[model samples]
Target: MTIWHRSARFHYRFATNRPVAPATGVVVDLSLNIVGDFVSHGGFRNYNPDITRPTPHLIHSGHGTMAFGGRTWDVGPGDVFVFFPGLPVEYADDPQRPWRYRWIGLEGPLALPALASIGLTPSQPLGRIGDPATVDRLLAEALSGTVERAFPPTRHIAMAWQLVAAIAAKPPAVDVDTVVHQLATGDPAAPPSITAISRRHRIAPSTVYRRATATLGIAPKAYQLERRFDLAQRLLAGRTLPVRDVAAQCGFNDANYFARAFRRRYGVAPSQWRSGQI
Candidate 1:
């Protein structure tokens, strides 16, 4: 059910028995529980009823200003904005052209990280949706879940993920360079994989490879290998661990192979290099 509040600006839906889907690592339980369609309020600003939850808004049409942290942005159609918990939000309609928008309230332990994946963080709270129509359609589907009083709002929860994917399909603030950087550095044992990056970012493997090569002058796999060796050098020099242990630490299953690769990289065997015999 929804409450029509023309005076308050929102056709609001109360929270429901929403099912949270938690992931394996860095668990994100973000589920769509509430949504609203906001109409114009002339030029009067409306404060958020609660600042203890994460709320993301999509500007359906018109231009307006969203204020938080003593800063304001002139937002336009297709622009999406979010505010983390404990942050105040205030907005009003554009005088020349009153603005209308939609918002979804997300709650869970890992809601902030979930939003950050789509590039909406406290530091950078606003991002332009590349395909606003897709995002719009998904949100509309979720908005309809307000009337579903069933056990679990599966459709709403599913729509939330689809919406996130659609928004993430576009470059986050037009920075594929940053994505390529993330593709270069990670845990030494588990290096960056083009396949994983392609799948997660919803981009082609060739696109990732091209960006990696263009930015670092080497592919992502090469970059990860170079990074792994940098750690190996540090470990060989600083730690008393044996070459075998070092090999294992660097994700090398065979000592002989590690020695050969280390020799090729440094022009000397790892042991000799460690002993300053290079």
Candidate 2:
């Protein structure tokens, strides 16, 4: 049986240094005096608010995959994820540990232009930012509210730019195909089993299993199960079909069993979850 986890209870504080250049004027000053744990245990999807201005987001990982922008990626400790401007992102942790992270939004005239200088764009689904120390400092400061006092608005905005520049300067060696393959093979909506996937790829089951585990850090079957669970969640969110019908369509034979599994994974019954969404 899968034991589920929930997001961490964490908080942060944010304040910006005053700007010297009018071009670099601070457009927004957010204070993260306190923030609830941003990660979700069991598996949950939440929508990101629409944004017209460039905003910076911070993501800390839990023990499971975090889904955003129609892709799922593995997250471990000390990992940092950035979502820039107007894009939607959602995340959830695994059965053992829910996703735990802190994030805030900042939009101003200089944001995108600064990011562009570093090869960072607002449109990509996801990317990492900064070294571990930088990420650590940012989070610690935000959570502890130290940045509010230690840095002025100008300095803070400059720091944000530095972070973006670091991301832009990093080599683009990340394997795009590897990420796509995971989404294609692991998404529950697709429901292609290891055997079926292996055949499709013209490889042995052991080879497929080994590759997914080695590259994705997840056993193939488990990955598929996660994807299937994601599909069920989406169907439930759509509110278009009966939960029993959803269970059948998603390949679970028993609706009661499915409900139990969903609740255990999501920390709420399907009905309750749907209600809360409304």
Candidate 3:
């Protein structure tokens, strides 16, 4: 494999001296690119470029959006897209939030057939999988090192095949239970909002609200607050940290506001709750 590019933000590009024959399914190039927010202008228009590329490419977006094929897709994390060989297509980052993605370029007589069997085509080349993290990990493992001696060709082929299979498998829809759990235990730094969650799951906000309320017997907001307060209670009970610190840890920035919210929820100050006093 020849390294065309490498970067600390996990951008990688590679090519092989010996192309995979039409008989053996194999990957010719693979890349993991984290096009950060710093990228101001990034777009590609491919219309039978001078260079010949005899392989289909599969791209998995970790985050951000892209405009392609005469429409803009709100490509959230875990979304996948494909580009067939010799096709004319244009794509660009959503300037506001640049994308991070992994792509595998594949060559073989079975490439298009395999992709078609799974309903991925140039016209409709988007799909999702059960485990985006696992796919990302596999791509990382297959493309590790300085590209001087990355994974051997055989290993790379195997990894690429595995990824192809995963993509071909129909992914289950995001369920209401999973959304509820995410709201309850999502990252404090990036609390899950109804809009964001709905977008991530590719559903309407109203659907998320209706499903969550039907399943959990509480509005999503109320459920999230209950979980946040539960976390706050645990933090208060387990530590000697200041009330303000506990509040911040629970996703509240203002101590007074946090206290008021806590009082409304528990009928006691956070300090009093910590002290087991009603």
Candidate 4:
């Protein structure tokens, strides 16, 4: 029931401020405006307490058990885990063989889907990275992004993404259905070009279109639109978040555009749709 952390939280603007960990339940807002927090501490430590992480983070460490989302694991150097936002977490380093770990946080609406496309989600977070040093090295490189004197924030963030892309398998894919599913479920706002999909997977554009239509019963673009609006409706119905957050979660970064598109799809603006205003 004790928590220990040597925190150096770097917010956006790359300010030189090392604040202690925010108390549990204090949420970190992952706005598209690009605010962030990067926490990394080297050397031996044991930390365990209920912590709700703000942004999705990748963790690599040795000699400890990570208790995440009610699952406990005896993790080693080759063990890497993802901590998505809003999940409960606890970690304890083995006193005998102490370890170090880093949290390279990811933001934006696309981050979660991109990770999920590779089979990394809160429900299934642990993975065997097999090369702890490479992961640790990437973490170190990403951490430098927090220092004001280091590289620009965007470069560091891209480096963070590079680390993520390096871990491949990386999903339950290979079948035509899976590939089609990946495309349909990718970022809703900017769907990748059909040509790019064909080139990457070595499939002819026409065949991809034919199979995708057969698999989903609709064009890929239409499938994505329906999927996006389905979630938007539920979120709007809940009324828990503002239109902006709803839009962001549904892969619409611009609230204004989200409103315009909402009207086009549902025949009502998001604000009006929430309360059934004609």
Off by over 4 Å in 4: 1-61, 130-134, 150-153, 169-278
Total clashing residue pairs per candidate?
Answer: 0, 16, 0, 0
Alpha carbon lDDT of each predicted model: 0.72, 0.54, 0.59, 0.57
Each prediction's TM-score versus the true structure: 0.54, 0.43, 0.52, 0.41
How well is each residue in 6-121 modelled by candidate 3, as lDDT tens digits? 44333445544334322466344432221111122233222433313323333443344444456644454556666566554455554333455555655555566666776777
Ranking by TM-score: 1, 3, 2, 4
* The 10-residue segment with the lowest total lDDT in model 4: 10-19
Checking candidate 1 for backbone clashes, the offending pairs are none
Candidate 1 minimal-lDDT segment of 10 residues: 8-17
> Weakest 10 consecutive residues, lDDT, candidate 3?
31-40
| Model 1, span 108-130: residue lDDT tens | 76678878987889888887666
- Best candidate, lDDT-wise? 1
Off by over 4 Å in 1: 8-17, 20-28, 151-153, 171-278
Rank by lDDT, highest first. 1, 3, 4, 2
lDDT of 4 by residue, 1-278 (tens): 11233444211122222222235654322211122232223233334343333233334433566676568866554445676665666765554445544454455456677667666777777654434456566555544544434444345445545566665423323566656776877766446556555534545778778888888899977887887888888888998899999988887878999899989877889988999832
TM-score of 4: 0.41
Candidate 1 steric clashes: 0
* Candidate 2 local lDDT, 156-231, one digit each (tens): 5555555555444443343434543754564364454555444333356676566667766777667677877878
